[model samples]
Target: MRTLLLSLTLAGLLLSGCSPLPAPAVQPTQAQPAPPSPTQPPATPPQPTALAATPAAVPSPDEATPVAAPTSQGGSLPGGAIETLDPQAIIAATLRPDAPAWLIPADPELADMTRYRLDVTLAPDLSTLTGHEQIRYTNRETVALDVIYLHLFPNLWDGGLQTTDVRVNGQPITPTLPSGDDILGLPLAFPLPPGDSVELGLSFSIAIPAGEGVGNYGEFAYQEGVLALAHFYPTVAVYDAQGWRIETPSPQGDVIYADASLYEVTFTAPMNLTVVASGATLDHAAAGEGEAIWQLVGGPMRDFNIAASADYQKVSLQVGDVTVNHYYMTKDAAQGQAVLNWTIAALGLYQRDHGPYPYQELDVVETATSAGGIEYPGMVVVASWLYRDPNQRDFFQSATAHEVAHQWWYNVVGNDQLNAPWLDEALAQYSTYLYYLDAYGQTGGQGFLNAMDARWARVGHAAKPIGLPVGEYVNREYGAIVYGRGPLFLVALREQIGADKMTEFLRQYYHDDAWGIATPAEFQTLAEAVSGQDLDALFQEWVYP
Candidate 1:
């Protein structure tokens, strides 16, 4: 969730944005919706300190609104960047993403999860639209899969009854839930034959009012030309080696993933806008005059995302096989090389410390929406506030680092963020601290971590942990715990297990749960089992104690 806002805000113009640890994740109780570059710095052996000046972030434009296009500006890539191409295929090959290849690695069904490649075309009025999804399945269990279920989260966006037309392998069908597990309740549903695989294709219509989703617009926000979509479709909840861990989205919340998959997205918009999405661009084909199709190919990922705009300043950074891209608003703080340079250093440092980045290229798009940050698989959207003034550059850097780390935590590890929001987001938060430590140092890192802690104290203490259920927590408190307290929990856990053991524990945890969604209980079992010690109390403190 920490990375989500960045994934949203950057490409927005105060026009579209994702919420950050809001007061309550009270969604409509129905389905819900929600919404980086590296630059090179001097080889100064980046310090693991605050990304910038030493004050807690003041909810300025950069913090609240989404990213937007630059205003009449010309900013070049920083010192060590190559901004010429999208580099989508290069990375796809490296990730070797293959969905529906049941016998392959990105096995969604096996994990009780599946993903679809989507193509959408929206009318200018925002009230009418079209979408297509490519679905794949991989069975995680031995059950003979008689059907395939899909999610149409957008159904929740409107009135939960948008007319949709689906085609599985080119054959038209309607997979909406019927009977007990009503497809209408899910927004989408479908089935496939047992132990076999086939393509699930869909073409549907959707819409939104002009300037909708501007601010706190119910469970989700929607506006023509600007969209923040989540839970817009229906999907089968995940049930794996663990259990039925189906999570739902609520007000200002996010869900969890167990298995990461590949995403290939193609979107068409009025010719004047720019498109930013998950994965690399496979094709930028010309449609009729005044129109174009942006083909995005992303794989070895759990999910995919795409956003479009007419105004944006494109930027890219490449540091030893790792390349990242960022979009700045014409109305941002600083433009050009300044942004690029900082990002390059951030990306390189991240690559060296954690693990080889899984994706080939990173895309950061600015939005007019609000919120500090949000993360998708390979793409992210950030607010323009970080670029609103030169005084705020460092926060921009910190925000960038935080979102990039999500590719590892929430996306790759695939944990149940609802039950243990701390599992996914907290890990990402710690990852941010790691970035600061690498870029700044102990003093700087601690300071930044403390600031986040302070924010949590203000919020978490005021509300109760979201207790409705693990699924309900997606729109609940683990953010405060996982992101805010989760790191502190790690800090303490490190003390208990010894730093060396912490490393060994993570190595084993990753090895066991690689590309699979993990539950809090599963993680706890792993931790205790690895340390040869009991940690019920430790987890209790971090969560409820």
Candidate 2:
């Protein structure tokens, strides 16, 4: 989520020396995990393919365990291998038969990735949601695991999430919420060895808060007949060299840090409302009287998001095999069309420079958000206020371009957004610059660069390191530095390396890390490799802490 302060008026706010109050920081007391052994090398980059043509062979029944389907009451299944699940069955269940070729995972390396199947229903008033999720998680780490952690992100707001009926492998289990209400720890019956997999079933109910006082960009709130549900479910946490990342998040930056996974969602909503969500809509039909059900599939992507409104009007255009849909209020039809145009332009430029977008559908929805824009896997939420204010046209364009660029940096090529946000956010900002250069030519590109200069000026051109964690910066520093000076660092690097090398570096980095998590070390290594110039001094002066 790009904060609201990225607007052109931020320079005036900095001149006035007034900033939003900082949220109190909650420091973690948990000991950090030891570093990886020296003998282990960094992960090799994956080939630039989306899905494998033929599925991997399923495990033999002798090697497989029986898994039970989740019951509505959250009861445990009978203790036998009554039903068995394999990778092919899970993939078939999650992916739509009519899904485009690109959405299928061609790379055999992604066979063990996590898969989620969700069945949820939204209240007629849009005040709450109740659902059950079945998660198929593989122990991708080298070391064995005794527990699994899940993040309940909506607990950070006034409303909260209640989880119940937790089961692992058809047996009931009690999970612990140790520190913050956001993290849930499930103790396994036994250690899950490396290369092993586990099935987790749980039921959750969420109280949707009103948008006014909801913080963290209000991405999870419901307001004025519009619902923006981001991270509305209990999502599994990523385990890295630092151990389970259950730290309480700072309100200043994006909340989720997760790997690419497959999602099959069955959502039931009021018939009057129109839904815009991540992924392709495989099925939409009447569920019952006055209600409708939508079956959607998205995958090998980071996260799933949804936006719904009874008053929404949509405009769509086909770009190649992908469809671009823009949803807006009835009164803002012209502005909605403009947004659609800009989105298509940016998407074309990004596809030319970066790789093709992996999904078959892209949605840009106008919802009530505190930030300029918030990006999910295949969808983005643009602030509704931007469409009403004519004076904010430039900010509107900048925000749209920035969020579309995230399709390449954040969704297709994954990163640890909580720690190394610059890997995506800074790159997205630079990609927005490329959009202006491609769409509007030199004059418009120079105008956008001047805005970047003004943004960095808000911090008085501070030489602060850009690689620090999100919590390390307080108040306006997070935006002023990460969103401001962070992009300038890329511009400087582009000058040091020739423009041609910089372009190749961006393309290579996208292909190499497609559908995988990236790190600061790997980023620098790739940049140096592409340029064939030692970037130690450049990173030391600009990026390193």
Candidate 3:
């Protein structure tokens, strides 16, 4: 969740001075999402310490067992030709019938652990949002659940969020706020047993903050005619091996840890504003004289984000069956196209190397935020400033590629971002290396590594252990270790075990943990399983060191 802030150094790049114009409200249309690109076996498997001419060969559909392999005319191709594709279609094409085996599990016992139906109305001035959420949750844990916690992430900002009333299973309940934090807890009137479900109706409001961020920590910002609403909802906290994860937002890095669940959102806003959110758009219609309602469905994803602006424009391209969209303002027309190309290329490269992207669409929207790029499921908010300087084009590309990589590392494969930031962040940074390798080959890939090494040295090369919580390091040290040194660990592993085995290890890891949170220990176990050698010494030097 690194926020790459690009200052508006280039003049006349944003149309912030221009008067806002009304945008026409149109019904949302469905598009076909892409399928996995076909893979061919390697001509000769490279020996240890050798990089393969092509990327390491991934498991073909036939060898992965019981799971139905993609068929030329059935799984990949659909309805005689390219027909309609939605989240369900994307899942059917990309996921195995027994997807729960490796990906996010949806057993009857745990399918509805948390389900949210949020109905929201945006103010005409684009400064606030009023909403009520209908949340249906089940006590899926083995023990009797006594309390439920909801995280109000936006509350961390000044004039941020307020919860009005809450009811559990239709009975009004007083919510208790945690001390010096943004968490609200509701003690269950009666202990909720496993397999039992309850409904919570909550009312809340959020006021979008106005101003530039201090660093890479802007959330409720309204600037340049764009409104970025990230982590704005009162989300249910995750209960895992350590119980409820009720931690508050931290300044150093991402503080969210959640289980993938379903969401159906209804957003009502001024007719002129366009809504871009996680998942797929199910419906859109006129709400009233000057308002419209958009129905969106997403998940089982860890989080959902919605961004809107009156001045936003979009350019889209079809890759295989999937549609990749780049949203930008009038000033970023040229940069918008560039982002779209890089997104499409990155998606293809990751799909070929890791696995199929199990979503119908991916959006890269330009926004003003603290981060250079912030990732959400099937969507990301990219810094508009990245487009201002022509000389820093590579920086823009690397940032965009890194965020897109999170679709697999952070989105599909869930993680405890608060406890083990390296699990996803390090892998995402390494993914940029992979993208460079796939796009520009060995020479360019090594160049990216050399740049990373130089940056690490400039940061004084502290040699801190990469496997640590977000709070352990300062912001700069966090970036230096996780984004810079963390990737080098993978490079060293590649050198030790060969590129083919390293890629195979990653493929296995992705396949096994596609739908669940994984820790460094789990990764090490998988690494040893695939490489047939102990990596304790290696991990000690770079990761645990």
TM-score of each: 0.72, 0.84, 0.81
For candidate 2, write residues 1-545 as lDDT tens digits.
01122222322221100011221133224432222222221112122122111111211000111223322433322221212234343345434345445545665545678877788999988889998887878899999999999999889876689988887886879999988798899899999998888888888999999857474556778886678888888899999999998887777677768988877678998877777777656567777888888776667667888888877776677666566777777777767556777788888788878767766678888887757787888788787766775445556676888888888887878888888878888888888878766755565565566666676776787888889888887656677777777777898999999899999999889888877788989999999999999999999998898
Error of 3 at 263 (Å): 0.5
**What are the lDDT figures for the candidates, one per model?**
0.51, 0.71, 0.67
> Listing every candidate in turn, what is its Cα RMSD in Å to the true structure after a full C-alpha superposition?
12.0, 12.3, 13.0
User: Mind giving the per-residue lDDT tens digits that candidate 1 earns over 268-355?
Assistant: 7666656666666655666876777765555556666665545455655454444566665545425545555545665666555544
Show where candidate 3 strays beyond 4 Å: 1-110, 214-216
* TM-score result, candidate 1: 0.72
After superposition of all CA atoms, the RMSD between model 1 and the true structure is 12.0
Candidate number with the higher lDDT (1 or 2): 2
lDDT of 3 by residue, 156-189 (tens): 7664688776777767788888755588887889
Off by over 4 Å in 2: 1-104
Residue pairs of candidate 2 with colliding backbone atoms: 50-106, 51-105, 51-106, 52-105, 52-106
Candidate with best TM-score: 2
